[model samples]
Target: MKNTPIGRLRLIGLLEGISYLVLLFIAMPLKYFAGFPVAVSISGALHGLLFVLFCLAILHVMFVHRWSIFRGFWAFVSSLIPFGTFVLDKQLRREEA
Candidate 1:
C-alpha cells in the first residue's frame, strides 16, 4: 500500500485506538477490579509512546493535508480524551475517503 498522508494518519489512529483500549479495558479494569495495577502501568507507558507518535502524525497531517491550525490543534487535543481517538479516526477517514 502507498504511504499516503491518509494511510499514515490511519495507522496512527489505529495504534492510538489500541493503546486506549489497553489502558481502558485492560489497564483501568485490572487496576480497579483485579487489584492488579501492573496492566495500567505497562499500558500507560505504551500509551505515552503512542501519544507522542500520534502527535507527530498530527503535525505531519497538518501540512500534508493542509489542515488549519485550529483543526490540527483540536484534533491533537482530542486524542488525550478517552475514546476521542476513535471519533477522530472516523472524521479523518471520512475526509480522506
Candidate 2:
C-alpha cells in the first residue's frame, strides 16, 4: 500500500484521523479532567504533524491522479471529522481496486 501515491495518502489519512481522535477523546480529557497537560502537549504535537503530512499527501495524490477540485476538497474535509477518514477510505479503496 505504501508503494502508490493513493495508498500513501490513505495510510496518512488514517493515521491523521486516529491522531485527531486521540487528541480529542483522550488527550483533552486528560488535560481538563486529570490535570495532565503533557498528554495534550504530546498528542497535539503528533496530531499536528500527522495533519500536515495528510495535507501534503492529499496534494501529492491530487497532482498524480489529476483529481478534480471537489474530490480534493472532500479529501481535505474528511480529515476533520471523527472517523471521516475511514469513510473516505472506503471510496478510495474502490478507486485503488
Candidate 3:
C-alpha cells in the first residue's frame, strides 16, 4: 500500500481486529479452559503491540484527516474495549468510501 494515513489506519484496524479475535476466541480459551499459558502470553503480547500501533495510527489519522477533538478522542478511547477497533474500522471505512 501507499502508507497514507487512511491506509495506515485501516492496516492497524485489521491487525487490531484480527489479533483481538484470536486472543479472545482462541488464546483466552486455551489458556483458561485448556490450561495453556504460553500461547496466551504470546498472543497477549502481540495484541498489546497491535493495540499500541492502532492507538498511534488513530492519532496520526486524526491530524492527517483533520478530525475534530470529538472524533479523535472517541476513536482513541474506543480501543480500550474489546471489539472497539472493529467498530472504529467501520466508521473509518465509511469516511473513506
Candidate 4:
C-alpha cells in the first residue's frame, strides 16, 4: 500500500475520514456537552493536518493518473461528507482494477 500512489492516498483518505467522524461524533460532543474543550482541540488539529495531506494526495493521484478535473473535484467533495472517502475509495478501486 505504501509503495503505490493511489494506495497511499486511499489509506490516507480512510484515516482522514475516520478522524473526521471522531471529531464530529466524539470530540465535538465532548466539548459541547461535557465541558471538555481539550478533545476538540486535539482531534481538530489532527483532522486538519490529515485533511490537508489527503487533499495533496488527491492532487498527486489526479495528476499522475491523468484523471478528469471532475473526478478530482468529486474526490475532494467526497472528503467533506461522513463515510464519503470509503465510498469514493471503493469506486476508485473498481476503476483502477
lDDT of candidates 1 onward, in order: 0.83, 0.92, 0.83, 0.91
Q: Please, what are the lDDT tens digits per residue for candidate 4 over residues 1-97?
A: 4457788788899999999999999999999999999999999999999999999999999989988999999999999999999998898777666
Lowest lDDT block of 10, candidate 4:
1-10
lDDT per residue, candidate 3, 29-94, as tens digits?
A: 999899999878999999899988988888898888898899988887777667887788787777
**Residue lDDT tens for model 1, 1-97:** 1387767877887788789888988889889999999888899999888888888888898898789999998888778777887888878777876
Q: Name the top lDDT candidate.
A: 2
Among all windows of 10 consecutive residues in model 1, the one with the lowest summed lDDT is 1-10
Ranking of all candidate structures by their TM-score, best first? 2, 4, 3, 1
- Model 3 Cα RMSD, 1 decimal: 1.8
Q: Global CA lDDT of candidate 3, please?
A: 0.83
1 or 4, which is superior by TM-score? Answer: 4
Q: Residues 2-97, candidate 2: write the lDDT tens digits.
A: 479999988998899899999999999999999999999999999999999999999998999999999999999999989999899889989988
lDDT of 2 at 64: 95
Pairs that clash in candidate 3: none
Error of 3 at 28 (Å): 1.1
